[model samples]
Target: MINKQYSITQAPNYWYDIMRGVEQGYSIKLTRNSEVVAMLVPAQYEQPPKQNFWQALEIFRQQVNIAELYDENVFSDVRDRCPGREVLL
Candidate 1:
């Protein structure tokens, strides 16, 4: 490969070609005012999946709310045993 500097154009076709080069073997650096800001790595390193605060909350939300809180068979029996009380589940 030649030591020719390349410019990242704002064209879709050019972007596609750049992505292909990146996939093959290329270094893409995002600079702001000639200062390096970020980059698109040629390949991603192996890392554990990340879970943000909301994502962790969502994962916890999917867990069972209560074991016998709303069991259909036991619900009616519990209701009969305790009447005039609000069944909030």
Candidate 2:
């Protein structure tokens, strides 16, 4: 990657130029008082690790609350039981 450095004060003025460089695979280092404060580089896409069926299920179980999932009382009054008016067609 092409590497470039700029002082904090100079970054704002060169923001668009720096971004264009970064888009073209340049690595930009922003310095403050001669110390490196930040870096802007081309983003990399990585695939997350795959989980097997049982492992995925275990994760799902850990995140869910069993009592909340099975709470009948919470939903008892939610549905409207009345029949709707009949349509012509």
Candidate 3:
């Protein structure tokens, strides 16, 4: 699967389109200050049809701790503070 990136400023305007692409198998990387802050990948990537407990724990460890560490809107901001790059996929 291919991966694409969209800045915080570009995301909300294209959120629906990005979601559609993720459903179709493209992994979308959401960026802030040119850094990948989040990824919108297919649900299948999150949990396979059947996975062992150990494998599941690995995925859990890689996840972000938004609930305990930061505000929910921290990454959702659409402000253009940092310069963005053209992410072609």
TM-score of each: 0.33, 0.49, 0.51
Q: Determine which window of 10 residues in candidate 1 has minimal summed lDDT.
A: 2-11
Give the lDDT ranking, best first: 2, 3, 1
Q: For residues 1-89, what per-residue lDDT tens digits would candidate 2 score against the true structure? A: 64899999999999999999888878999999999999898875235788999999999999997877786687789998889889898
Task: Give all candidate RMSDs, comma-separated.
Answer: 13.7, 9.2, 27.6
- Runs in model 3 deviating more than 4 A are 48-89
Score residue 19 of candidate 3 by CA lDDT.
92
Choose 1 or 2, whichever is better by TM-score. Answer: 2
Off by over 4 Å in 2: 45-89
- lDDT by candidate, in order shown: 0.58, 0.87, 0.86
Best candidate according to TM-score: 3
lDDT of 1 by residue, 1-89 (tens): 32112343332446776677678766666445555565555664346689999998888778757554665675565454545777789
Give the residue spans of candidate 1 off by over 4 A. 1-13, 47-89
